[model samples]
Target: MKKLLKNIKLVLFFAGLVLVVFLANCGLTPLTIEVPSVVNANEVATFILNCGTEPRIANTDPPYTSKLIVGFMVPKSWKAAQNTTVELISSEKGNSTLVLIPSAEKEAASGLAWPDAAKKRFGIGPNLLDDFEWLVYRSVPAYTFINNEDIKFKVKISSKVGSENSFSRLGFFILSAKENLRPEDTDYTKYAFSNNFSVTNGEGDLVDYVNPQLAKVEPVKSLDNDFISLNFDAGIIETTLSNTDEIFLEARGFTKSGQQIAITTKVDKTRLKPLGGKKYRIDIWPRGLLNVPQNETLDRFEYYFTNAAGNAKVGYGNTADPFRYTFKCP
Candidate 1:
């Protein structure tokens, strides 16, 4: 009985040791995340993140100084720096404004800039589209967290929507400069992604980044200087071009002054690149595709998809009228 008791004690001791190591290794812990699912562009959307750092077992005997960084994976149209505000609240230091940092500033621990460091640590955070951008911010007056003290940081984000109706799984990443999240240490760098968020009461077609769509445009917001992609997903919806194996683009561009330039988009020059599962896409440069002169700027486009050898054609909502896109850089 004595020997059996000794064995049991040893097993329990090892289990407790493992548990302690796990807790000691924990770095940044996000306690609660409150995010909105859908919001109006005309209104302000708010979200909160309650986070803490584990009281270190030993090296924490000395106070550590570091700035906390938060990155937002948001729609480019939001102009997050101009429209979003980040506030950091700490019981020890009161509330302070978290200001946006230029993406080019390099982190001491990592050779890359904060944005590039974050991208290397976490890429896009499960967002499907490439139109999103990362807006990085740092808490003001680099804070020194005391040793063996229980401190919590509350981050509040208020975002104002831009003039586009769209959906995206917004991403947030939090980390401290003290723990720049090298490859071996994974605890401090934490990523939190919101649900399929939406912004309505804006302009143009619904630029959906969350789910599959029948037709869509890339870069949600772009000017003629930016190259844009037109996508067609025939499998998601039963359109006139559903069974058409070969698809071609037919489009017309209009200038700001209403001068029309018809693009010769129906030939092999305008063929869409086929992606499996009945989807296709074609990238176009506005001025080049329309053969526009340097003096005139293209403003919008009307486009359609048609079968290579048949009369089957598809337009907006699979109708006869062409699908329209109004170009606005904002």
Candidate 2:
């Protein structure tokens, strides 16, 4: 009996050590959910879901692993659909209508080439504004099918007003996939596939950096020039550090017909010496009229300047200001 007890103790000790190492390793790896970058308005942005460091057995009996399910979040103003369309009416008592029907061949050409419709049956067309959802459960197979695969969808914009004033607001959605889940999973009982996304009107993703706010925008002069001299500042609230971070400043004319130009964007922080106590000055113009546009029809000009200093891995949000200049058409 004494020998048997010693053997049991040895087995338990070794098992505990193995379990601890496994858990510790899992915690050290970074897990992330990244949405695709090319998604446009009225388009479906596919999601890349990664399980933790390694796939672990989520269920013991049937032998299941972690997988993802997606959900959609849309603007309150829009709905999903089979095909999207618009009706155009002019004040001149003339009206025209356009219809959109889904075509596998047509949709496939939107991006890089797609596989010649495998044996899988193609899904039917969706209403342009109809909000409908379905699921692709048993994600191990689904994941394998879509591994490195990009899913595509479209958004349709129409105008009752002329196309000039008619515009569409694109939406950003959050996609969540249930993983490390169990048959009796109750923690996320209300969870579903990717569906919840916020909406916006712009050229970039719907992910808006809200908290690390832009406190102020200013134009300061740091030098005397024969042409135009300008400086700008931006105040950033508390934030983290990030990679591929760029300071984006944009100047737009009220009229699309007006010409707008951008000067060189690269600014060296080391050269940007400190000004006042909490402020720093960046050289906006070396000399001349800047990289101003040729046309004098510009109604407005704006700029965004960004740089990365200190710890960049975590992303930092510092304050900044923009400089601008306006001139009469020659």
Candidate 3:
């Protein structure tokens, strides 16, 4: 009787161990997220996610079928830029998938293999198998809320497992612009000057003269922040007054509450050159330049030009109509 009882207990123990291993292999493991404890609303933010074990990639036909999804939640009053979708591919030998190209096309083009294509796409070194882990970088543009209060941002990650789904939360982190000390005077008034002064030649006529004209105004969508690029016609300014006169682009950003933010003289070094004959483009990054009020949306941007000579023109000609760029601010 004692020997029979011991045998029964041994059998039960083995069964329980097998059951635990099966459950672990079939179950989903939560991913660990690493992010900054505090983030600046005026700068780009990044997050990294780590998985302990190889995530199961459903053997789907399409390579681009999203295996992992990430989302961000901000305050109702605050706005966030568009979300980026990252598709995770299997890195296992022979099981590696190339989602960049369709399977049909892939099979048709027989000369190059899928592994070669993946190597090129991922910029993997020669010893690809040695590097088992893959890292993806995602950036979110900076944004500020209305009030000085701290704001929490939530990040969520989900993965599809067979017919069900596994989810993980990254929790929340505080984002604020005021937490970090900023320049007190963010207005561009100091850079604002008169546009009445001009230069003349020995003939006392407008010779070799150039008046700044608004050529093109467009929004630059980027991971840093939504910025405005202003192109100006510097006609002969490059050769004529390139050394003496300083050209400045002025822009006024208005909030829904009627508060005004401006970018006057601050110019990026890269955009401080003449594109061609009298063509200059100035890109305005609003992070530190445009002081947006918390919660209020920037509805429109009014742009003009000024120079050391104070004779810069606003539009194409003297009688040109008023121009402004409108956007759905977030």
Candidate 4:
């Protein structure tokens, strides 16, 4: 009976030790986010990352804090520049995963593969990020418990920035909890928090370049119809700079068979005529130019702008704003 009592006490002591270790392994860290209002294709947005007021033991041993990687998505029509730049704002102490993708078409050709889970989480596909490519830059290791309020570093964008038209510049503040951090434990109670920022110099209307008004597409009855039509208000950002050359428009169609038809040619910019202060519309149709088959599930459409110099930009285009009530024809 006495031996049984000793065994019970030992078991209880070990259990308590395990609990203490678990508590020590897991903690919390706060992360605040402040994204820029706008980022130009070729311009860089400077940012600051400061760890706020929080006092806790940072994981110093094998299991360190989480690692963060940043990313962005460019629009399809953007032409890749010769030299793209990405400058870090904070301490350039750690390694990052910065890469440049030429076009969504290059993904399949790049021979890159990922688990289904990561693919779905990041919305990886040919078109979702089709027209654009990617750029990645890796940073070195950094372990600074920034608990004070101060501005960080100034990261620069690529010199080969895509033209504002073709590139839909995006910023991603990515975090990976699995790196060096405790896997079995879920809570991060002892970490600090930070709010990121990007600097912007000016503001302009979406109409400055194209018509600020909405764009329309004349819907067709059959998917196999060889012709497609679209209409939209023009956008012109600069009034004084009237090199008013030719404007080009392009059409893309996503079919039910998981196929997309992109335009070999662009629309005309001169078609834009002012309706009011910043309102105008243009009608577009690829009659003999485009050969689109009649398919029942004609999903979406997009319109972009380009000048005679071949400079391009993407305006607004939609799938829900139907120009015609689609019906089957016997």
Candidate 5:
């Protein structure tokens, strides 16, 4: 018995219980959220989360101090963790820089990384697409909530957006350090979403996460070394290809050294694969399709759809002008 007791490790269950109880009494409520509806890509945009914590009577002298764990749901392409910075201003704790949580820490409830766990719980919020990630951070030192006094906090997020002209619903999460994202203790956690945040000044095709599109380029941004796909749905609008039994891609790739290469000859190589419902797509290697020299770089591609015989053509928005796709990946 003595040997067993010596080998056994001791745990402080009471301290843990006290912290949980204190969190149950305190509540985080959002007063206002300020985030721009539209911002240029690669520019620093500011988001302010204004909230207040409810007052609660202290069970112990220290009142169960805790550090704030905050998370933001953003586009994966933005690489927010590396491109963003966070600051916290509180009525109680003064000012402090919010530090990113270590990547190795697992969420207590989900047994996954903090960012992945957040995605599993709240998801992509109100956005229609699923190409976003959660970036989590925590406040330095700990905060001690005072009894009978509401504590207010302002979290400022400065992030440099990615180089994609896309829109998404940004999400914000707040909770105490020990609370995490516990399923049973969900009430202690708080979250809010922005309304269709958009990026206007970006390169290549517009990636709208808010709605379904009729035409799109696979790998929205790519270079000559990448395999590209042009996808279109003829039924979405009345076009020359909408009535044609067979559709073909008519494209001209421009080389950096001022050379025009045409990939549209209405041959077997240019035919689009039909996916029923008037949907069609064709995959192509930019370098191979244009027969471009490795020494030369591609500038962009002007393209359109054609009938089987190559007479009728459909361009941007069913206009006579050809649709253009720029090779603008960095």
Candidate 6:
């Protein structure tokens, strides 16, 4: 019985030693993240990150601490607002510092690229913005120990108004001891985490960015056989236009036999002035300006208009209710 007890004791001792070694070898703790449930487009938002383990510089000639790099992935339809900036604040100290996140490719290229080990571990390739899909990363010197520290950061994001819809998912990443770390390092994965948060509208009204509305179209009297006058009620132009900007009118004529002909005419800014109230008018001469054959037009007309930005008003056709008019040769 005594010998058996000794053998059991030796086995227990060896197992405890092994467990201690394993714990000591494990360098980093898993990272934790928190983000807001909803964020507005073209607004600044806050995200929180907690670094589990203290970051340290492995080897330095002068014994200086390395850098902590934070990365963000902005979707293709989103853009970093002009003068977009980030502020990192330490939760414990309430101390904050300004960090610049570069939107330009020329500036971004100057940063360190992820090493092969990091790329393989995270399953990500070279980070680059494709078609306005931006990946912004910024690094700050790890001057203070950030073990289990909650770091709060503010980010400003703007939507490519017309390209983005009601929602977009943004990705985030963190790398500790970035200056001394390589992508291929065995510990790279341990000190990093990648996750995503979504930005969505709370009320769910996705406003149209550049849609122009055509309110009314009136066929003013045909001026002789050479020209036709049309009064266009182009409802409130929401977008501000420069002096050089132009609006175009598209007119389609259908004959009694159903043969269709179309022509486009440019309406200068001078003709698009306000008519008394909120309504605006544009006098168009589609026949003479577009060279539409006057002899072939026997029946109906369709009208559509567009601004210089390609924002078009809904097309009007012969089947339109209440105000539909059929052209008759007089």
Candidate lDDT (C-alpha), each: 0.78, 0.30, 0.36, 0.37, 0.81, 0.42
Ranking by lDDT: 5, 1, 6, 4, 3, 2
> Residue 116 CA error for candidate 5 (Å)?
3.9
Which ten residues in a row are the worst by lDDT in model 6? 124-133
Ranking by TM-score: 1, 5, 6, 4, 3, 2
Residue range 72-114, candidate 3, lDDT tens digits: 2221111222222232222321112112222223311224333
Model 5: lDDT of residue 283: 92
Off by over 4 Å in 3: 1-213, 220-224, 235-245, 263-272, 316-322
Model 3 weakest lDDT span, ten residues long: 186-195
lDDT of 4 by residue, 206-230 (tens): 2121122244333322233434344
What is candidate 6's lDDT per residue for 1-330, written digit by digit as tens? Answer: 999999999999998987666455333445555666456554566655554333333334454434445554443344554334544555443434435444332322234443222233343322221222334444453545433332333323222332233333344455544433344444322333223333444323332222322344333213323333333333344422222224455556566667766655454622454554444455655444335565654355565544555454434422232122344322
- Candidates in order, TM-scores: namely 0.82, 0.25, 0.30, 0.34, 0.71, 0.38
Write the residue-wise lDDT of candidate 2 on 1-330 in tens digits: 999999999999999988776444321123233343333354443444332223222234643223232222222223333322323222321334323222232213223111111101111122122122221222222222112122221211221111111122222111113322222322321222222233334432222212222322222112212223222223333333222234322332232366545543344521334444333434433222244444433344544444443322111134233433333211
Instruction: Indicate the residue-level lDDT of 312 in model 4.
Output: 48
* Superior by TM-score: candidate 4 or candidate 6: 6
Task: Give lDDT: candidate 1, residue 269.
Answer: 68
- Model 6 earns a TM-score of 0.38
Q: Give the range where candidate 4 is weakest over 10 consecutive residues by summed lDDT.
A: 203-212
The superposed Cα distance between candidate 6 and the true structure at residue 142, in angstroms, equals 4.2
How would you encode candidate 1's per-residue C-alpha lDDT over 155-202 as one tens digit per residue?
Answer: 898988777888888878788767765766657777788888888888
lDDT of 4 at 146: 38
